[model samples]
Target: MLETIYTENAPKPIGPYAQAIKVGEFVYPAGQIGADPATGQLVEGSIKEQAKQALLNLSAVLEEAGSSLDQVVKTTCYLSTMENFQEFNEAFGEQFAGHEPARTCFAVQELPLKALCEIEVVAVVKK
Candidate 1:
């Protein structure tokens, strides 16, 4: 059976989609942007700042799904510009320090709410 995941710690979906979906032992979290859950506003500042918030949001959704960043087996990151790659990488490295998962990042033309960064993940539910 599939389970939908939701958490107040993360920004609510702006469209027709759940925060995440879990089936069997894996959970797939939708892309998380830099918007703050409390304000539903995109955070201001550098790409690193936005990347951090996006990761935090992704983490919250995973936690709500009985998973965690450490349990993530894969990640897909989107950046508005390649110029921010280094700074974004710095923030991402800080978050996944010891347990880096397989990842793919793309420099997209844009993202929802004009966020500088967005991240999504697939993780194994902790037993």
Candidate 2:
């Protein structure tokens, strides 16, 4: 059975989708922007700040789904500008730390809320 994941610690989905969905041992987290859950506002700052918030948002979703960044097997990242790639990588790298997941990143024309970056993840949860 598939289960939807939700948490107050993460920003609510702005669209008609769950924050994450668990099926068997895997959890698929939706793409997260840099919106703060408490304020429901896009975090305002540099690309680094935005990337941090985005990772925090992803963390909350993974936690809610009974997984974590360490359990994450793969990730897809979207950036509004490739020029921010190094900055975004710096922030993202810190979050993942020693557990590096398979990842693909690309520059997009834009993201929801006009944010600098967004990330989606897939993780393995303890059964």
Candidate 3:
């Protein structure tokens, strides 16, 4: 069976999709931007700050799905500019330290809300 996941701590989905979906032991989160849930505003700052917020958003969705960042098995990162890759990695790496999940990072022409970075995660939820 599949279950939809949501949480007020994470920004509400802007389109027709749930924050995450759990099937069996795996939880897959949608790509998250740097939008602040309470303020409903994109986080403003350097790429590192934006990346941190995006990871935080992904973390909230994982928690809602009965998972945690430590359980994340894979991640896909999108960046608005390749030049910001180093700054983004500094923030993203700190979040997943010691838990090194498989990942792919790429530069994109744009992102929703004009976010500097976005991240999606796949994690395992204990059954």
Best by TM-score: 1
Kindly list the per-residue Cα lDDT of model 3 for residues 1-127, writing each as its tens digit. Answer: 9999999999999999999999999999999998898887898899888888888998988988889999999999999999998998889889887789999999999999888988988999955
- The C-alpha TM-scores of every prediction are 0.97, 0.97, 0.96
Candidate 1 Cα outliers beyond 4 Å, as residue runs: none
Colliding pairs, model 1: none
Candidate 2 stretches with Cα past 4 Å from truth are none
Q: Superposing all C-alpha atoms, what RMSD in Å does each candidate have to the true structure?
A: 0.7, 0.9, 0.9
Instruction: Estimate, for each residue in 1-127, the C-alpha lDDT of model 2 and write its tens digit.
Output: 9899999999988999999999999999999998999987899899899888988998988888888888999999999999999999899999898889999999999899899999988999955
Task: Judge candidate 2 against the unseen true structure and give its global Cα lDDT, from 0 to 1.
Answer: 0.91
Candidate 1 colliding pairs, count: 0
Candidate 3 pairs with clashing backbones: none
Question: Which candidate's lDDT is highest?
Answer: 1
lDDT of 1: 0.93
lDDT of 2 at 81: 93
Question: lDDT for each of the candidates?
Answer: 0.93, 0.91, 0.90
Rank all candidate structures by their lDDT, best first, as comma-separated numbers: 1, 2, 3
